[model samples]
Target chain A: MTASPDQIVVRDALKTYGTGAAEVTALAHVDLTVDRGQFVSIIGPSGCGKSTLLRLVAGLETADSGDVTVFGADPDQACAAKMIGFVPQVPALLPWLSVEGNVTLPSKVNRRADALRRTLPGHVHREPADPRALLTKIGLGDSLARLPHQLSGGMQQRVAIARAFAIQADVLLMDEPFSALDEFTREAIQVQLLELWEQMRTTVVFVTHSVSEAVVLSDKVVVMSARPGRIDAVIDIDLPRPRRQGLLESAAVHDYEDLIRGRLQTAWAAGPATR
Target chain B: MTDTTDTDQTGAAPTGATPTGAAVADTALATAATAAAASVRRRQPSRSLLRPTIWLPAVGALIVAGVLWEIVAINNTYLLPRLGMIGQAIVTQPSFYLENAGVTLSEALVGLVIGFVAAVLVAVLVTESGILRRAIMPLAVVLNVTPVVAIAPALVVAFGFGPAPKLIVTALITFFPILMNVITGLNSVSPPILQVFATLRASRFEVLTRLRLPSSLTFVFAALKVVFPLSIVGAVVAEFSAPGAAKGLGTVISVASSNSRLAVVYAAILCLAIMGSVLLFLVTLLEKRVLRWHESQRLLRG
Candidate 1:
């Protein structure tokens, strides 16, 4: 059963802070929808409620007014049903476990270790490959037995991403999982993530401030505005899949990049006057 | 780098404080006057195997002090005795002092164990509830403030001259620091660490086990170091206050003091010293075994 049109629907979703004097509108009267299997990126500057939006989709927080649904079910219900996987920016692996153990934890947690076993590729199955193969896709194979400290910054975040995928969830919600990495590592991970997305065809709602990253990764970039963060534009990137570092040099990616930068600057300019 | 040249020429790191410590001063003078010297390699952190060096010097210093006292009191056997005389008393009266030492050590150990268990449980409770902390913190203040000397008499009168009073007194004496340190340790999970756990939706127990407990081990062991001597002091005070008590090291010392058996008194004192050192040693060893991944313990590894 592949994805259809009305996959994740948000209707009149409101998240307001305190009332009257203490009032703050975090996500005000937002309404948008991403089709099933759509790779969407919600890109905006800091405090544009990008994180608040992702948290809503992940079912980590509730909407104050309206609805958020995943695969025709409520976000929270669908999440509990193991329909979503989240990779927070921080490396959230339990420090006590090895990398392989951390990657396999989500499976073990759900009484679904057999899923990881079945998902193992033939070349991986023959040689007793580590579950680290998933992590290795993100370039952390050398650290199977290593703890979090032993690995560098980019490597630990790779483990966190692998752990998310191992659970075999349909949706991947990432919150700028590579902002902390160096430029070289960040680009490398972005390319590798594209490869995983092409193969899995899973929907992703990536939250990021980097316009270039959003342009490179998403099929649709849903640009957000300031304060009571509402959608400004939903720019589509119809570029081909398995795109390379060379693709970043292409006119298509740059065209989308300029378009998002223009929209974000306008949002930023209007932001201060309202205050 | 040339940034290290001054330190390299001096062959010693400068003092961390405003003034130089003896270790640094000794290094500079000793180095400047000499050459072909081996570098001071930050003292390759002493392992459990190497830790005995710390005790050896202290014991040696004690022995030297005892010898000097014996030399001064060669004729006056009442106030002080010869080092040889104390050694003879310990060896010849093996059944006499050893039994008493054993009795005192056992009571101290039992008190420490009971006190430790009670302290940990209360610490966990206090950490969980502000109400419980408010209720118990005052009680802990009372326990800490009430000296063993004053309370030992009442404990002895209640539990009598047996090991019961001695164990109870010691337990009360050793409980406060252990409880306070443990409570602080249990609640010491940095907010960031807890947030990581919570965002992962890790269970509260998992958070406690992996994060909180690992952090608490160091503090708990520090409390153990403080409480070890307290255990012995408690046992001794309990016995000393109840002079009617027999079969304790304190009883041996009290009797020896009255009869002017100076060698026996010195022998009992030696036993107490040995007991304190051994208990502290065991706790340190346990800390190393349990927390090999700890930063302090990892530094100690090399």
Candidate 2:
């Protein structure tokens, strides 16, 4: 059994889109490592390839060069093992499926993943959480039978969150999941997500543009610069565990947010000169 | 049902029913009354259907059209048959028209079923591979552009003077719309949802059955709406162009018109029109029931 503490490793990963003059580099020699059970958030400007980085880790795309590994295996293998869970910006729930059916969807289709996971030495397999109980925990108990369209935007996002959590995946990748929601709904769901994360302690790599969100949820916040995306800084948030919305008022949290913002400004300034 | 509506009217009275002395009792009573009224309203399915306001214009127009038709027939009996004479012809030998109507209806239905199943299966296969799609789609388009009426006589020559030519011609006419619509539907799954399925390692069958098929339903229903009425047209056209031993409304209309039996011709045409309308209504009803979860369906309900 391999005993690496790091659950995810991205080394010198480079990805580009298009070709010829129109070709643009999405990620340029980006490197990141996420420790087991760590909550890491990747935050940057719109074109910083934060989503590209998340997609790489989700095995949804291949890097032009370098490597991405989860649980000592390649991203595709880990994904095949049902070890990667994704929550996209949109809820992306099946329109015909009820909230319960949407939550239970991963479990139903993961037969191939299950068999792959069994072959890995020292891989601990827990029975997936009951989708109903997870839905209730996420405050969707009453909407169990409702289709995705029937739920409000926030409620639909919560169901999406519940679905990702239900698989008990070793790695959860979220791409700006709360960006579409209103301010109040976003904050409420952020707290709910933290609570869920505390229980699971699965390695998470969340991509977002919100600085406060990154500071609140992540153990390590990865700030990337745009124009050929590269990691500009990695800031460790020393906030106490069981983080709540109440902590947003504290000075320490504000300091971390400011520090990240300052670093981001520097990264942004560092770009145009090269262009 | 009467008692419920009665209670609803009384319960919805403008605040005067509340007792002055007991405010708490008044609140509770008001709440119960509102709940009862709401439930009663829900139990009465589509009150708009029964409303005179909704039906008055439609009924009035039909009545006016009927009177105008009768007046026209009185002036020109050869060209425009009186409504009574057409009705009399149908009443005198109802079984003859009924039998022919049944044949046309059955042919349309059987052809529609065959067309629908074949289109769906082929669409599913086509969606699976670009190679098959490229190879087959042009052929389908070519077939669609060729008038099935023109092909009906050749079909009769090829398949003999039986029901086969009529069924084939009908199936050919209805196939393209459904195939095109279902193909579009199957490919319409959102990228994020497709990625979710990919991450789950969902098999091709799973993706097709659970995601693609359900996603395709709204499109399928849209196509069926057009195709249902068209299926009847296809059968009639086939019957007209390729008449053999079979007796359909198309054949009846043609035979009556040649003999200048304008009443029987119009009567046969009336049967065809009614059959088309009833088929279209059934498709709409099925769509409403099946696509209840769809956004278009929900908006329609409102």
Candidate 3:
């Protein structure tokens, strides 16, 4: 069978914060691509610019140079088209809005995005999931009227996840969505996320610090180094589907973990790359 | 609620694993219902001021203060009027004090409404444009620092013995705090949420209505609590300073004190105190109702 089309593409993308003596490169000449329906995780140590890369893809920040595209359009165009979904590290749910209100917020906004999409010749179109149904699938069905603070951290992130999915965007960019959660909660939410992703088949670019988390949730794990945040290696997980709790202890998963860990160590030791 | 929750769960249950899934969902729902019931019970007590936790000590302290004032006034009759004498004076001509209070209260209310609207409009403009913020904020600060009470005679001289000067003074006194607080509240949104709105491509209007304005309610209420009582003070001060002003609580105090009617003077001051407290209380009640979802209100309840 022919391969799926490229849904996201980033070429030589560079991003920096501050200026002069305080200048710090967040993403340096970052090049990456995510195919349609693929689950890719950008895994690295802290300060590795994975979140910056996600932000760039989400069109929340601009790259200093190079190209970033979603569905062959600029990130801003994709954002305006409502083709990009983002889940921040913190849930970032609007405090005043109830869970249902928060989940359904995207529906109330970006009507112009649809009109813009209609102007395009070839555009990705998918059915937006009902917010209530998505909430139920994520085990927060009864909390529709509850405020964001009324819910636990895990539950709030679940709402965030549901909200991101409710938009039915072409690509989902998550920045450490589960890193704040406890291990059990994270794993459980990971399974719930995978179940949702399996049904929607939306291209996902997730950022995380966990090795096994990156392996289990993503088809391809991108390992990045710090100081000058750039891709160190990209490892393909050939493991079978339904990668549940039991898969974490499996020998093949451990092998992939070891390989990623070893590369991460070398990346950690590399320090700032000399010109 | 439980029935609705059960129906939702049953409807969501898959086709094949009906028995076990239904049992699990039932158990989960039962636990959730218990927790919800417990939370509801915990939050059941109304926050009305009549509640013993608030009013019991309030009444007790008020009685003790009244007795202490009576004792002090017995020794120093020249300065402090006895509580009973003040009460007698008020009862002797209740309509006189009431009419003057009515005039003062009307001035304060009208000025307060004008001030709030003007402050909110200017706040929106200030937040929308940096140039406006720079131009308007300093002028507001200048107005705030230049004692509005000191300007009452000038307003009276210019405007000619009318209510316009008193209303203008009250509005000026009440404007700055609300403007400052509103500016703070509008800018109080966290960066990540702003980013989320940006990603959603929400229009400026949507961002203002759905995000900025809702978040600013707490700050607005806080400013209102201070400025509501200050509005009354402003109107009274204007009446005291404006030479031609003949009918207000402040004028009653000025005339009675000059005539050595200490009881009447104390009575007018007492009326002003009660009016100020009532305005503050009304503001608080409105705050509680509007900010039920806010963290500050939740913390107060517990």
Candidate 4:
């Protein structure tokens, strides 16, 4: 209840779909708190409500019960204040727009939202980053005028990452953003993403099913179980900073990855029958 | 390595003037070659236009069809005129066909403009409101299923004679395709993109204008390909129903056939075909320009 202006707090948030005989619970009693500028990952088996948690925090879906707050305000208010940026699993660049156009769209739209927010008393507004410079930093300078279909899968995902960074949001929620890329491209983008995050210092809540991915990018990984989805455990990643491809071969990184994998296996085994 | 050493020894021999002069000659030759290649590249597209494979088959087919038509007309003169006679009629009364064809083209174009705007407006409304979509979609389906030819007479009665009925008929024929296409395009946005817009806190109007509208352009153009021909057919049908004092291509066809001027009738039919082709070509050009960034257009260029 004492969540600060820079933190995201979720208190026993629940979400359900359908009704009566067909009713299904997606999330149950999910309580999590992501502090300011912390990179958190949610990892679980399929249909374990990992993405549902991100959606709740994004204000895209309302929790059936309990509360979710961002920066001491409702998720809706936080979203309206242009503090949340989301990247879906698919690289959802507009097909009609060039790479630069897609990257700049959020910034342009946020300007209008910012203007509306300023009409209200005591609203703080932050200027978004330059999209061209951001795209160049993300290594997409050569593809500014290329359409979405012209780019490879990995390139498109990088564009999506650059787009999320371009918005200059206080918090970013990504849903398995690199899931579609090959292993090599995924690692490259991970490094690029880490560099961007390090520079911006924005809070991130990334949802993924890959243990190595969660371990590599997140400060803490929240593991959840399905069949009435709920969080089972939280694992803190103690690996050193500036995590790079070299760290992937390190014994310490392997140990952390193995620990999370073991917990995920246990969580998967502890199903509805055990509950 | 050996080549560099050889060049170095040669330069060290105090005959640098000879090597330097040779290098200058080589640079000039390279520039001349590059310019020649550039000119060839510049001429490539126009050369492709004149290639035998591109135009020969089409021209051959047209000649064969013309010969067949002439032969058939010699045996059945009353039913089908000779190709030469139709050409003579077109050459003799060019102004008559031109004026009537212009009237039909104008009607179709006006109706298309009105129907396109109305379809876009209705599509926007349906996309924004679930209630309107539910109520209006079924009615649109019913209208689409009803034949325009069957409605032409009723339209003539409702709007009376003159161009009003023709315009309505053309609008009616075109409205449904545009509506269906616009709705499909507006709704075809990927859910992930919608989620991105939602996260950005884009206003409903912004979502419609920025995302939905641009996404719908390809579909709109696709629908236009069908609408172009359909609009002309509608105008001709409407003219048939009510061809007052204002003569259109449909009136020309009816009048010529009644007077047994089969050549003039064929000439009018040719004019209609040409009009349809021209409109389709214009729509395609517009589509290429507007959808240059789309994958379909990109694939087409390749």
Report the lDDT tens digits of candidate 1 across residue range B37-80: 12322333333225555467878998898778867888676677
Query: For residue A108, what is the lDDT in candidate 3?
Result: 89
Chain A structural similarity (TM-score) per candidate?
Answer: 0.88, 0.96, 0.94, 0.93
Q: What ranges in model 1 sit over 4 Å off?
A: A1-6, A16-23, A72-79, A82-84, A108-130, A273-275, B1-88, B125-149, B188-203, B206-215, B260-262, B299-302
Poorest stretch of ten by lDDT in candidate 4 chain B: B16-25
List runs of model 2 lying over 4 Å from the truth: A1-5, A273-275, B1-45
Candidate 1 overall Cα lDDT vs. reference?
A: 0.72
Q: Kindly provide the TM-score obtained by chain B of candidate 2 when compared with the true chain B.
A: 0.85
Stretches off by above 4 angstroms in model 4 are A1-3, A110-112, A115-127, A273-275, B1-51
Poorest stretch of ten by lDDT in candidate 2 chain A:
A1-10
Q: Which candidate, 2 or 3, would have the higher TM-score against the true structure?
A: 2
Give the per-residue Cα lDDT of candidate 4 at A200.
Answer: 81
TM-score of candidate 2 versus the correct structure, residues matched by position: 0.91
> Can you write out model 4's per-residue Cα lDDT over B243-273, one digit (the tens) per residue?
5636899989887788898999999999999
Task: Give the per-residue lDDT digits (tens) of candidate 2, residues B1-302.
Answer: 45445544643442222211122212345345334544554554467568676678899999999999999999998999999999999999999999999999999989999999999998998999999999998999999999888898888788876788778877898899999999999999999998987877788999998899999999999999899888889888888876555699999988888899999999999998898899889889999888877878644443
> How many Å off is the CA of A44 in candidate 2?
0.4
Estimate the TM-score for candidate 4.
Answer: 0.89
Looking at candidate 3 chain B, the ten consecutive residues that score lowest on lDDT are B15-24
Q: Global CA lDDT of candidate 4, please?
A: 0.82
Q: Write the per-residue lDDT of candidate 3 for residues A1-275, one digit (tens) a residue.
A: 12123557888999999999888888999999888789999999889899889988899888999888776778788888888888888989888899999999887887888878656433766666889998988888877887765566667788888998998888888999887776766777888899999988888999999998998998999999887889999999999887777877899998999999999999998876542
